[model samples]
Target: MNEAKKNSHMVGTVSELSVMLEYAKRGYTINLPTTPARYDFIAEKDGRSVKVQVKHGSTFNGERELLGFSKTPYNKRDVDVIAMFDSNDGTIYYIPTDHVEGMTSIRLRIEPYLYSVKSEKALIAEHYKKFIG
Candidate 1:
């Protein structure tokens, strides 16, 4: 029986969209480039700019989340910082862009996750998924 194909696009809209918005709320300049592209947004804050491959776990749950955080060997292009985030609860875990072996849609990369920021603006919110680091 053809169980109705689950609509993936709708979920991506909810999750990835939330991730982008949360980044902006925290004062990083945000950008959404044309789709069918390499990454989702470019976030610049504290004099740093990054090519973020934003992932919506519920967004593209066909295993792309695994693509983002696989702790394996990879080429140098993956060195620009990568992130796997759960925006709903405002928690994102990231690492150097080259940690994972392969590439896929979703997995994001942002740098300098740890630093001394103004106490009032620290990203101390909670997230659901046990995000990658």
Candidate 2:
């Protein structure tokens, strides 16, 4: 791989590590970044299982925030919680599959969504609890 690709991979790895630590500090036991082997981290808390996808912030040069989701094809796997780490400030965020619906104003059409990360995570945990346990 080219140096740039290598560097980006390194950054992503670091970001995933940071994510794991954050979840751990929040009292969740977590699996490290083994994503694209699909799924980044699997966190378990209070007998709940939550799958997470960690992504770095978008590439932008201007001062304005370039907030948006990727328009590439997705399977059911990609629709789950997509977490992002702000490269500039390192704030972790959880974006659910339903968040794509918020793209009404964008050229890439998306559906309407209404739910917070806490709720989404809770639902995910409940759904996967059997397999996780």
- Local distance difference test scores for all models: 0.47, 0.53
Q: Where does candidate 2 stray beyond 4 Å?
A: 32-36, 66-79, 101-133
Please write out the lDDT profile of model 1 over residues 1-133, one tens digit for every residue: 2333345455446656666676777788876777654555677788877766654433233322332332244333533444455534445555444544354433432222345653332222222233221
TM-score for each predicted model, relative to the true structure: 0.50, 0.62
Score candidate 2 by TM-score against the native: 0.62
RMSD (Cα, Å) for all candidates, in order, is: 11.0, 9.4
**lDDT of each residue in 1-133, candidate 2, tens digit only:** 9999999789888878877788788889986554453467788888887777666655342522324344453333543555565566666656554644333111111222244333221122112112211
Best by lDDT: 2
Error of 1 at 31 (Å): 1.4
Clashing pairs in 1: 53-108, 78-97, 78-98, 81-109, 82-109, 83-108, 83-109
Indicate which candidate wins on TM-score: 2
In angstroms, give how far residue 100 of model 2 lies from its true place.
2.3
